[model samples]
Target: MKLKELIFIATGLLVLTSCIRKEAPNQEADILRCILPAEILADKSIDYSLPFDTELKAYPIYIEVKGETNLSNLAPQFELSTGATIQPASGSYQDFTSPVYYTVTSESGTEHRPYAIIIRYKQTEQIPTDYHFEHVELYDNYYIFYEETDNDGRFTWASGNPGYALTGKASSPYDFPTTISPDGYIGHCAKLTTLLTGSLGEKVGKPIAAGNLFMGKFELLNALGDALSATKFGVPFYHRPTQLTGYFKYQSGPQFYEDGKYTSNKKDTFSIYALFYEKTNEMPFMDGHLPANHFESPNMVALAQLDKAQTIETEVWTYFEIPFDYTRYNLPVDTDKQQNGEYYLSIVFASSKDGDEFRGAPGSTLMIDEVKLIYE
Candidate 1:
């Protein structure tokens, strides 16, 4: 190569090297200077059973500066992406309260990618206050009583068993191997609505008769209908009473009997009930379907109404009663007082089987109204 060309190429390479040197140092400075708050394991792995103490609503958090990069004159701020709060750090370590959340900010008075920490709280034995529905009655015994009236202008029909929606009609089951359409039993329907009342003692020891065979516990029937057919000398399983919580809205299960059953010629029996569950979408903590079980939380009973259009509204009255024995079953700390734990209510139904059998058809609608919690 010519000497002139060689000199020109060398000069160009030197200029390029200088630019690269400047850029590399700046990049290195960022890596060495950035500050991160703290880190914790992601939520799905968190065990909810750890011990914890009850605080107001929020917890205080602190963070320690990890490196000697000297992040002085800057304060750190943290935020949860959802359902969490953070107070100003009073010290070097970040402190956090439950429930868990995300994100932390630096107090450098500048906007940069903020450091983050995973905050976790150990669960504690502080039992939460519970809501109990102690006593329930219909209309304070003023409006209508089932025993006094023969029919009371009530009927049970199966509008495809599942019944109708507010705007559009949904498809429900019909003509199953043991199913019928739109049950219209007089005595059975009365029993269904009647199951929503009475003293606390009657429901304590064993399961009782529930509402009509066509209508089931609200817990089991939140958004669907049911059908049943049973033969009876005593009560069949389908006619047994069930228990449910207040969260349930509607349900239907029907029953029917065979011919030539009872010697004395007694009619069949049927019912349903509502019970409570501790966790949402999990097995019920206490279910009325099985048998009478002791519980600390009071149960609520509602008097609801449903129009022919299947629109339901009912006024619910609450009662608070502590069981004679509440120390068992690891109940909440305070049951003697009213406002301690979450109150729950159960709705139940029942029925009896005789010599012959009874049958329940579809399209039976039960409407509840104005259900409210009266906390003490």
Candidate 2:
């Protein structure tokens, strides 16, 4: 019984080993972190500061300096994905007046990703208060809304279209959550529609995308992994805004979905609000996560938000005005900090109020037009 039984056991063990699947090698080639040394931006005369750690996550990494700083020759440090390498090797001097492209290759050599580095001088420019929603342009295949400043600088509005593009469900500009609408109180308007994200989004636990427009930048790198933090809110503002006035038309979707499931008790609602906050080295800006509180933050000085009672479902163009409630923070606005561009203002519009949490109705729509900010 010994030899035959031993051979049978060995055969069974071999079969079991063969059935165990081998995991695939890591193929990600991404720049996880980037930093510029203080020596490169040292200036005693001008108020110069190093870039924030969070700003490195942008697609085209932007390094902002307070005053004129030499960017022709500089070195940068980068932390890449495990077993990945970047060419023009990290910590090497390169001209950054224009964008410098670096290519990263994966451990398996199956993936190659390109990253752009841009150096910009920090300048405070007050955005125009009036927003007529008349200008738009196409990028890649989707529409982008932008406004022209008095100084001829263009201010582009950010949306979740880029994140939705990852799902491969959008075939045209209209397929996106944000787009332009011909129907407006005047010539045209910004139309936001909550849309289904389909298979890929379902797999990632984000089944729907709410139509959103905001004064901020969308960090695409963090879109899929951490959507809440991907939306970097607020831009530098020099004026004191007292009120926000706008006209909108809203229609809720037939079915409400919460946490990716159908819910009969809830109805979809729209969101329109403005945030004014003091920017410091500690707290540069806010995000969808709202780390301090769900909607309140210690840094926030004032807020102008549309009340839920005022956001009724109406096909007609309805006018509404909200005043900035500065009572939240008893401290008065610091005139010195305001003049130094240490304050920021952000206006946000969304078809679904709880969209960032992946809860909304697919067909809910909110059309916004003629938005204006009244200054004190």
Candidate 3:
């Protein structure tokens, strides 16, 4: 063996080792960057639950991290309990094959948050699906509502519970304006009723609450920031809605008010409506506070508004169905949004039709059951 040749090979190996040492840590050093923002879980592309170590099983979660494609690049630094451990540890990669639960250490190392991470990737269907609102669980008195997924878990059902929670003051499910009713034509129904806010509400000119449930989330942080901006509505729906069918019983409260001032004696009327919108492909979501000018939105693809005459206080669970009135169509009539489903479907229910503007009676109520989406 030539000593000169051997020396050249050893030098090359040393250079290669140095390069690998420099690159490996760079790829894995972003442990802090990989921590998903709390908002990412709210979007329902993933699922999250509380109370770690529950027997109830959750699966197929995809944790979303902005700008980083490889989740394994940065692992969360979690201070676990006795015998609790985070897979792959900090600064490692892991496939979210199951739920991840841990007590996250505070930046100052003084405080911690216990979280159980679960994800059920919503596989977008090319066909129409029905929402019966039969499945519900009590979480924070908000009733984390969802439908069963094919994998035996749940697909996320976003609601306006956060809006009510802003005023709930730790109220129980029974006390919430939106609660699951034991009575329904099928299993159980959603009951939405207006609540009279006491002194705290009076100060902010928010004296009454019109019960509401929608297909999207309620931005609680923004609910008080701007009530109009609080309601983030919609779901990624592929099919254009032909009609919406559901049973509802409504009764208007006697006195009407606007902005904490006595306005009129008009009866409060319930509203059941759906918005089919072609969202910007780049942004794919309608931010909170959009329902204020939804009708005039550039995203308006279709709208189905219930007739006021049909929502009288029947008290008997009456049936009602309304079809979509397409003011615009970005796609052809016979198609779904599967070519690139960049649309959001929002089905909204409110005790008072004008309640979005804070102009409704305090005691108005609406009970909804067996809601289904009929599509083309």
Candidate 4:
């Protein structure tokens, strides 16, 4: 039998023994005995971070019952109070860890149990500031330009568009093709991990500390507020003078992993960084925005004008954009397929000047999957 049931039987047996032994006056004393309340196994105090961008997150709390009982149909209830007022939980999960009091009543006696529970919120913070970045080479692969064959092939911009075609590798000659520009603008891989030469002449993979994801642009516009030039000038411009714009998304940095194990030691805080450049030495053409900061672009046409440069650190979840002024960085609306000159994309990781020193980057793999060239 369960502990509660066994206790009930034991209590009944004691009462029967007392009645048969009869010392009539002792009957009152025999029925009067102390009954302790059940014990809740879970701890009362808990600690945890709040969720990101949320009001309150929920978790489950556990309670266990034990010991002597009576009153046959005894029901268990929990009360919440701060020593001032008492209230009951709609249920355990209904109001987890809010304050609570547990009480059990029996025909023989009454027991009141006290308890405390801890509630934790998720981590919600603004984006970070400093970060280092690098760009993936667009020409790492190739694409087929065009061909005539079977009559069943339907061509969209994604499949090499109108008259010609290109494969990812063969199409490398053109920075951004018309087919991939609108929705699939630019694609490049950024590395969150880097190799560093230690003082002892050993090369080590140092993780990028803490930082946010960022994007920058270089716009080429005209006097009529129409579409103009951008990094991917291979595709023909529909408008005589169009505006160019660029976009990308970001998530928080990863936790530090050292020697393949996660360590809470102080040696593992890292950050990510990113920036945009016209050429290698020019001032950072576009700087990223932090979550705490306010950011908005005045025009939509400028996305195509940007050539992205990005980085990562210890932070996560940040997005940014740069506006193009036709007056500066005059971009070419037409093709720049001169393919002879080499363009550059550079990336680097900055250690926490005062952060963790773990052996590897916590979450240092950069993924650049989407590429697009927008016309609007």
Q: Which candidate number has the best lDDT?
A: 2
The true-versus-predicted C-alpha distance at residue 326 of model 1, in Å, is 11
TM-score of 4: 0.19
TM-score of each: 0.22, 0.83, 0.71, 0.19
* Cα RMSD, model 3: 15.6
Task: Predict model 3's lDDT versus the native.
Answer: 0.63
Give the per-residue lDDT of model 1 (tens digit) for 54-123: 2322222223232332333333332332222223332334333322222232233132222233243322
Model 3, span 90-139: residue lDDT tens: 43544444556444444334444445444333445532355666778776
All models: lDDT? 0.24, 0.83, 0.63, 0.25
Q: What TM-score does prediction 1 earn?
A: 0.22
Ranking by TM-score: 2, 3, 1, 4
- Tens-digit lDDT string for candidate 4 (1-376): 5999999999999998877652322111111111223343211212111111112222122232222322232233333222222123323233433423333222223323333323223212111121211222221241222212135431111111111111112233332221112221233322222112122212223222221122322122210121111111112123322222223333322444454345565333323222112222232222222211211222111222222244233133333332333443344433232121111111112222111232443333332223222222
* Candidate number of the best TM-score: 2
What lDDT tens digits, residue by residue, belong to model 2 across residues 1-376? Answer: 9999999999999998889687666799877777776654421122112122233432455667646567788788788889999988999999988878888899878998777777667666788889998998787668889999898888889898889989999899988999999999899999999998999999988899999999977777778888888777888789898999999999999899986689898899999998889876677768887622556777888888899899999999999899998996764798988887777889999999988888888899999999999987
lDDT over C-alpha atoms for residue 267 of model 3: 70
The residue ranges of model 2 lying beyond 4 angstroms of the native Cα positions read: 1-27, 39-59, 82-85, 106-110, 221-226, 291-294
Q: List the residue pairs that clash in candidate 3.
A: 60-119, 61-119, 229-289
Task: Flag the better candidate by lDDT, 1 or 3.
Answer: 3
